[model samples]
Target chain A: MALPITSKKAIREWKLYIFVLPSLLMVGTFAYFPAASAAYYSFFEWAGGDAKQLIGIENFRRAFSDQVLLDSFATVSVLIVFNLFKMIPSILLAVLIHRLRSDRWQYVYRVLLVVPMIVPGLVTLFIWKFFLDPNLGVLNGVLEFTGAKSVLVSLDHFFGWGVFFANVPIGWLSQPQLILPSLFLWGFPWIGAVGVLIFLAGLQSIGQDVYEAAELDGVGPFKKFLYIELPLILTQVRLSLVLLVIGTVGGYGLQLQLLNEYGGPDGRGMVPGLWMYNRAFYAGEFGYACAIGMILFVFILALTFVNNRYVRIDK
Target chain B: MSACPVSAASPAPRSNARRDWAKHAIILFFILIELFPLYMMFQVSFKDTTTFIRQPWLPTNPLNWHWENWTFALRLILPYIANTVLVAVTGTVCSLVFAIFGAYFFARYRMPFSRILWAAFLVLMLMPSVVNITPLFILLKSLKLVNTLWALIFVGIAAGQVFTIFVLRNFLEDLPRDLFEAAEMDGASHLQQVVNIVIPMSGSIIGTLGILAFLNMWNDFLLPLIVLRDKELFTLGVGLIYLDGEYVKQWGQIMAAYFVASIPLIVLFLFTMRLFVRGLSVGAIKG
Candidate 1:
């Protein structure tokens, strides 16, 4: 049947548009317009003020050749790998929590895990920094109690193969090579709280009847999870993956907090986001920062698109 | 391991004992790991710089317990806390009002451009905030809102409203049409129906979105960093960053500040965790 399009309908439509106008205007002015400008700014060379010059593709060319930019990209790649290592355990822990029958225990676990997330990032960083402090850290205290020769192990001996059989002193964050791993260790404990929340939500959305049906078919817990739960929760997984990728690529506030804005020792923890900030604000390389940001944005967009596609297929 | 078929009755006492131990151990392990740093922060916050440097792990022998640190940190942090609360609450209220109306329209009224608007929202969700940061900075400057808390609030409201609207619309759209029709037969105006029916029914979802928004704004660093230049107008996140930079190597003092800064958020999270979890599950399913 054809729908009627009378004057009343037109009037109602106008009212609806008017109602949504404020939100639309806000998004357009603050979000969409700036996004468009960010893309445009990438193509030109402009500082803070009206003083501008058009240097077409030169900014991009400089970005490509910049050693710091390349290092930042390498740093983000390593962060992504570490993030996956964190995410897997987080999901499993969330599943285990969901399976627990006791509501009191579940609630206790939830609150305990989430306590880390609620703690301000700087506080967590400070605590971990102290905990991992070479001379007086609790970690070293534990190490010494376990009969280690030196609390602060040298990086070479620590990373070397024979360290397992011998006491080898290592500087976790002070050493350039070990900085990424140290940062990961500091960051990983907080993931379980957020991941568990997201995964628990995903778990509840997977209807019980589907699980019951799988059970009736003599499917074990492992097989049921593989065949049913995994596919159903792909959307949540995709959402989290996209967030993680964007976060790792952006490497903005979190890394700055963890590394105290100088990046890790020897700039080993310089992610693209901080590099952009350093260039634009610290070094006043506005054009170069914009170019790097544009590239990073494109990378994140592509990753998000791929994630959406995978999510759709899984659904 | 032997595979034993379990009856509908209770399990063996030995197995129950083992299971109880496992559960307790698991819970204790995670709780200790998660809360250890927080506990350590508390302990260190009480000690002076000398004590902290001397023995970072253990409590100070003298047990200084510098209650003055809290006062100092509070004095420094109160204005920032006020600014943060103002930004978060105002932004959340603004977004909620806009989203409730927009979502209701999308759910009930068949408009010509509804689908297009929805599609636009979906795309906007994928656009990272960093993509807009530079442009937003310029825009806020042009509006003469830089160095102001309002700039942070407005930008946050704008950036955050889309997701809330999407979630709210999905939820309201799934409401049974019969209820709306029943309300219509009772001579209810659109406004009346929304006020009398939709708002009341959406309590849980709204609370969830509000908590989420509040948490996001409270923890946000970038927007406040770009917009608010005055130290007095800084949010906690940005304030902590500034504090870290300005204090030099006073790690103990900084950690003390960090601990005090986290208390409000931690309290808020604990109080609303159940609702927060429920909201996530509902919003996820609907989305």
Candidate 2:
């Protein structure tokens, strides 16, 4: 039933191959070409114009010693840690929704969870920015209203933190020392709708018999979650973990929008992608930016490889 | 089997009710926390600056609600919304069309270099878009497509092809091969087979992928921000950013604009809620 390489049937089947051409062309021209050009242009001194001079490995050399770039990596590492902590709420929410006894209520909650996603992520970021506003933000209003401000003020006094004081509005996004914490505070109760749905899918696959077995063993809810549910959803967890790393590492839109081009006060919020954006756009160091991009590509590739290699789930 | 002490001869209905109440309270608490910002946004959208600052966390009186904020924001963002919808719809349709054909090829026939072609698409998924932004910008400029909606559509198509094709190919692969073979025996061309059989069989999937591609384009500001220099050509995402910068941070008007920007996707989701959920679950299973 197979056609040999030189057979007439294969020649006759050539027309079928036309189906793939358009996609290949689109991908080759738009996606692959730019990536290939990034590699090629990484060695040049181009300012995004006609004038470009070849300077092999110099761009990479500068990136190695760039203090801001190194610091940006450190900044992202902190955000990554915060993001890891953030994943827990989604898992918890999914488990909660999955365990609901009423099918009607379970369906209702799942739909409710997805409602937030209809709001564009950009709009959400801006809303959070408004929330972090020092003078008129809801966060500060609630803090002052609930007497949390007084507690924070007392704590600041005890610790000599100097950042919190009574009667003075706290600059959550403005003060350099507060930027990273402000980022963590963004997307509060971070039950990502999609993440929850994903984990729910995994959890729903557990047979009812498993739960009955657990019930027979007198296992409490906590132990049931630990022994049965957690293990079953570990596959989804690992997938999310890989995705989370790649997204956090490569993402700069949040920092770019919140902190501006230079990454806010003292560049406290700078990440590698934002730095690359700044270099290419503001500084006109397009070549060096490409080099930075290449470094990021390699780093992400290796990180993904290691993640898949080490984070094993016994299926 | 040994019954648990709790579930032995008679289960405690009262305790189960209490536990159910606790679960509902916990879930509701988290949901309230999650939805609080959006709730604040909606409430603030109806207030003037003075009212918003004074009553920062509460809804304004109905008589004092600033409907003009909505009117003004609607006027300002209407053009950007139109541009975004045009780009998203056109790009989604084109990319889906391309992906359908490409996916059909991979799913149906095993031709020479099929593995290489499939690998090419798969590899793009691993490559981060961040690394390609600068060079992609340059490539667009040289092609003289910078500042044009076509640039966004083209790039969206390219970026969308990999995922759409990957997912659709899997769907197509699972379709009964006999249906295709029967059609082929009737002297139907490949294009005809796709139109007659593939499209009809995979309508729901096509709809799902289209929504996803449309959403990706609608939310994407970075590419549009980089490519489009003209204010008139700005999509909603970039337009909102510019509006935020240009305005004096008027809370009511800005929040109203944000609300207006969110309406299209919300309406889309409302109508296609089931399809959207199924799409995501499908992706979850596959991923």
Candidate 3:
């Protein structure tokens, strides 16, 4: 029997709210409340857990004039350029795996590819630091073995930028000149299991009829990739791009600082997130840290809005 | 880069063989790049500290290898593994339980402010979690949870639950109405219908979500770093950092510790890639 539309019906509908209430309370306390409080803290001048006073945007004004903060933005921009380009390998690996004729080969590649994902990211970074070490590095060893060290020296002299030095020993993690470039080169070949899986899923959704039609016109592999696969997988590509943009710009730069390296080599590798963290935890300037965080949030929020508007895969 | 000639219906047999070789070569090259660093760490874990420093790339002489690193590293950090599992499991279970209740209700009922609340949750899901650090630390410290696993568990259950709820809610929304309607026709109450219909229907999704939450919490470095302080309370992520500090000059020991940190997740992935891949491919990372 259908229940009449009355107080009973209203009570049942509202009963569901009880189920949602705990979740709401938890999220409100942890995520939403913190976010709101972050905004509120931005206007105060508090330090070392002492009594506070209203600062009235002083921290933000300081953010504008802060040279270190400005340089961090530039450093992040350069790092982001490399991060964006890293998507190419992810796409390429996805395509290669998709094109494999054998099911066993596809399974093998998928399983093998996940190896990198399981390893801790920081461990991989640690290994890369060792791999690129100037004195004891594998990369430099290869250069010496191949007798390309002399060529690198000549090239470094020709460029006059100290950008390429094989025999002269490049400082991969030190030397402000090379640190950003070294950071850019982080996550070399950058294809992770998630990226490949996302792209493969996108590629698998394409109809065979489209490829068959192209084949009839004698479109080869390269043509098929360019005209068919690339366009079709634009959504997946966009998804990866937006994620990379956010991760590089807002999320990971703080990680570099947390490693206790702060800004590598004369502050060339500084980022706003790290600066915010330094202010809050190190300097005990919680209010200023919140203000700095608000500045970074504005940039991230703007980028996220732009990405959602322009780069949604579902569209 | 050239397309096939218009006159040709198919490539020549010799060129076909050549093409296969080229594709295989390229695939093999990428695979090596993927596997090389991992292999480097694994191989170096067998060397003595002195040998590793003097001849960094030398092949480990099986006879001369120092296997003590594994024993040494594990002895130091196995407690952290246990701690990590305790926190990760509790956080994941709580997240799943809360998500199941919240997602099912949100899916089945249109209560007041539900849409607005869900929209706000969605926006929070998209916002960079780095933004939450400053205030969350203060909040957790105020509650005296800073040096305990509960801090990570609570934060995870609160913030980490968004993805699980979003995924499960979408899955429930797509459920066939007839299934639940038939239950309603039988005079089953909403709770009974949910117990009978929703729980059983979402079994695979529950598996996917549970594994993802577990892995996410386990691999989490930042939250535990910010919250947990005592050496005894360190999860594997934080433990691995401390391991690095003690073994900074010992490549063999560091590599051993790294492998110790990596092995559990690797084992987990090997067994659960089917569910893991499904969870990943169905757009969990959309936000």
Could you give candidate 1's per-residue lDDT for residues A32-74 as a string of tens digits? 8887877777787887678878888999999989888788889
Candidate 2 lDDT score relative to the true structure: 0.87
Residue A244 displacement in candidate 2 (angstroms): 0.5
DockQ for model 2 equals 0.49
- Residue pairs that clash (backbone atoms under 3 angstroms), model 2: none
- Candidate 2 wrong stretches, greater than 4 Å: A1-7, A313-315, B1-19, B284-287
Provide the TM-score for each candidate, comma-separated: 0.87, 0.96, 0.92
Model 3 residue A279 CA deviation in Å: 1.5
- List the global CA lDDT of all models: 0.72, 0.87, 0.77
Give the per-residue lDDT digits (tens) of candidate 1, residues B1-287.
11112211235634433454554676567668788877787777777778777777777654568777777878888887887888889999998888888788778866777778878878887777765666677778888999988888888888778889888887887777788779989998777888888889988888998877777787788777667777777888788777866744565666678887887887787788777656545444433
Residue B112 of model 1 has an lDDT of: 76
Query: Per-candidate DockQ versus the true complex?
Result: 0.38, 0.49, 0.42
- For residues B1-287, write the lDDT of model 2, one tens digit per residue: 11122322345634443456677888889888878877977889998888877777779788888999999999998999999999999999999999999998888766788878899889999999999999999999999999999999999999999999999998898898888889989999889999999999999999988888888899999989888889889999789889778657788888899899999988999899988887766665554
Candidate 3 residues B111-139, lDDT tens each? 55677888988988667788779988988
| Candidate 1 ranges beyond 4 A from true positions | A1-8, A147-171, A204-235, A260-262, A310-315, B1-20, B58-64, B185-187, B247-252, B280-287
Task: Return the top candidate by DockQ.
Answer: 2
Q: Extract clashing residue pairs from model 3.
A: none
Taking chain A by itself, what TM-score does each prediction score?
A: 0.81, 0.96, 0.91
